[model samples]
Target: MSTNRQLVSVDYEIFGNVQGVCFRMYTEDHGKKLGVVGWVMNTREGSVKGQVQGPADKVDEMKQWLRTTGSPSSRIDRAEFSNQRDVPDLELRGFSTRYH
Candidate 1:
């Protein structure tokens, strides 16, 4: 379906108080709800890294949620968004949390 409305993908890295806060679970749930596909995992540097692909609007909304209201207990200091690009189709089937 190569419609005029192209989907977008963004890579983000979250910092601060994310590790023991169920951030990945919450992110998965949110991504599923938003119909975005990508993978999220905890980095060795104590940060959350993932890529989200979906409708441009929804992706933007997800970014907002990730940066502002991540899991109930997460205190997100900042969300760095990068590699934003347009995609012809969804490369992911569903959102999932990756263990790393």
Candidate 2:
């Protein structure tokens, strides 16, 4: 029996007409469907900040989808990722609109 789990954390900033176009909503919906756990919000600087954590491969797939198909009529400037050691232990129930 093997009990090894692989998890990863991804942070991305999507830009260019992303706000007001239902980008966050779309991201949240898709992320949930992909079994991702994290938050997505619009930054004051006209960008979307998102953090997703899950299986390594699933996380990567979600990132790719966000960069390509997940973007709703918006231009994705960049998507960055890093290996995180300390991740919060919380379950993402659903995606919401955040004003900040």
Backbone Cα, N, C clashes tallied per candidate: 0, 0
Q: After aligning candidate 2 to the native by TM-score, how far in Å is the CA of 80 from where it should be?
A: 2.8
Top-lDDT structure, candidate number: 1
How does model 2 fare in lDDT?
0.70
lDDT, model 2, position 1:
19
What would the per-residue lDDT of candidate 1 be over residues 1-100, giving only the tens digit for each residue? 5433679989999999999999999999999997788889999999999999998888988999998999999999989999999988988879988986
Instruction: Provide the global lDDT of candidate 1 against the true structure.
Output: 0.91
Worst 10 residues of 1 by lDDT: 1-10
- lDDT at 35 for candidate 1? 79
Give TM per candidate.
0.93, 0.76
| Candidate that scores best on TM-score | 1
